[model samples]
Target: MRVETVLLKDYTTLGVGGPAKLWTVETPEDLKRATEAPYRILGNGSNLLVSDQGVKERVIRLGGVFQTYDLRGWVGAGALLPLLVKEAAEAGLSGLEGLLGIPAQVGGAVKMNAGTRFGEMADALEAVEVFHGGRFEVFRPEELGFGYRTSRLPEGGIVTRVRLRLKERPKEEIQRRLQEVDQARKGQPKKKSAGCAFKNPPGQSAGRLIDQLGLKGLRVGGAMVSLEHGNFIVNLGNARFEEVMALVRRIQEEVPLELEWEVWA
Candidate 1:
């Protein structure tokens, strides 16, 4: 186990935020020991935007043994999503290909029910092993209450491992699906961002709504809305957390449609 005062920007994709007390746990025992107090479980930090004032809660990150996985569809919480997708493909697995380019870990993906239009993590999730309430327990899909861009995984529950049941598909077919997912993402901006800044409202696309409002290319300090995809807010240079939230607030206040925040701050 390791603990240090680390800048939140270094852990997040947005490259902004203040310092935090980070705890890196390499073993299950370390995880148990670190859970004695209130803490936040951070995965790949892909869909997070920390405040410039920083967080008071200690941040826990899984590592070492937690990063290992196997072909039978057993994956650790720290296992990168893209790497798991590649491994699943090589093993003739199919359900995870649609999430090819997502920058998240297995635990985070499962918690958020992360997915594209084609599929979601829930489609492949068989069981989840989480360390919570001072004990480890396995939860079935029905227990998660999966829904659009969300899951009810209990507030303090820390997902440790996940079991997936992917369909056996021809490697060629799986590769083609992955290629299509990659191709679809080409239209999105390739800049420093926490993926989509806003969640798609029911029966409507957030990008389309923002585009319809002519809000693309909007800027606040060093943060700006991506012209490529209106749903994305990019960090041009030294973006601040307040600036990003300011832009988000502007959109929410000005736009008639209610825009839900996707990035956790």
Candidate 2:
């Protein structure tokens, strides 16, 4: 197999990290073989934070073969989430429109039950095909034990594909909805960021709470909280992971003391 060292900054949306050991797998066999050694499966690297010293573990990245999309049936795990949603919408399939601007791969999205106002990926998932241990198995939505931002697959299990059942909708309606989501996302600040930094706690929004506490546009080094939306911490270029982490910690500390609401990381 091929192996290389890569700057995590180049792979992650935050654009801030050091080097990481990387391996790319194009087939299930390759994945199984790679898993014989210790490794972590990575998607588009949208929601993860690599340490300042970089990831100490080998990172397995699925390639184009695993990224395939079959709108009529199931989609491969490596498929880009936004691309899958776009393809499904263009094919007149409903249920993934609300995920329009979210950056992640199908495998990562499914693992986290990614969703928006319309609904989550779990809502459309019919079954999941996974490679675990040395064998493959299929799991229905109930069997997958889907919950908020988590799934049942064991820590090292690799998701191969997912069968989604989407409703048939008018293409025009689908396009309009996607456009609306896009418009809403565009209204947010444009900068280098890791999307949302923390999950909303209980019934309250992390953004609103952070904003209410007057943390908007707050800065630590080059990392700053987005003025457009408080929950997002944007990189103003030349920002480092340590700086971002420091800002995150500051938010966690200040918000609770100032507003009496605990924000999670």
Candidate 3:
């Protein structure tokens, strides 16, 4: 295990946070020891918000052995989602292109069931391996209770690996779909953001609702509602966690929307 004090902002996509002690564990044994006390496991820090007053719990990041993966559809939890999608495409496997442009680790995607309109991580997942309570267990998709941006992963569990069920398809076809997804995401904000700030309620679009409410470009400190996508809050150079939360509160006051990202304070 490697221990270091890190600025949380440097690790997260939103670029807003204080500092915390980070532990990078290279193996399962290292991870087990790191989680023996009060700790929080982080993936790519893509969908998180840490406060200006960062928490005291040790932040755990996976490394070394946890980054190893194969084209046979088995992947380490620490592997980046986009890398896996690209690799699957090269292998002529079809099923994971939905995550092509997502900024997340494989494990994070599974935890959030990250996906586009076509499909979700759960659809390609055959089994998940996780460590909790000093032991590891495997779960099949049917047992995971996957839904919109959600999963029934065990509380406090750290995902170690995942096995995907992909189909043999032409590489060109997979590449074409990946290109389409890339094209579709061009409307997303290019600034630092944690993707959609609010979850869409059943039968309604959160972004559309925010747009209708005329909340675009609403600013609080250095944080602002994205002009390109109403569901996003972007960091204009130096955003603070409080500033982002203020914008969140402002949106909530006018729209009955809940947060889609996690907040750690």
Estimate, for each residue in 118-146, the C-alpha lDDT of model 1 and write its tens digit.
Answer: 78889888899988898889999989899
Span of 10 residues, lowest total lDDT, candidate 1: 256-265
Task: Output the worst ten-in-a-row residue range by lDDT, candidate 3.
Answer: 65-74
Best by TM-score: 3
Query: Which ranges in model 2 have alpha carbons more than 4 Å from their true place?
Result: 256-265
Give the TM-scores of the predictions, in the order they appear: 0.96, 0.92, 0.97
Candidate 3, position 216, lDDT: 97
Candidate 2 local lDDT, 81-165, one digit each (tens): 8888878887899988878887888888888777665577788888898888788889888988887666788656788898887
Which candidate would rank higher by lDDT, 1 or 3? Answer: 3
- Pick out the ten consecutive residues of candidate 2 with the lowest summed lDDT: 256-265
What is the per-residue lDDT of model 3 for residues 50-109, given as tens digits with 9 covering 90 to 100?
999987999999898788887575689999988888888988999998777889998888
- RMSD per prediction, one decimal? 1.5, 3.4, 1.0
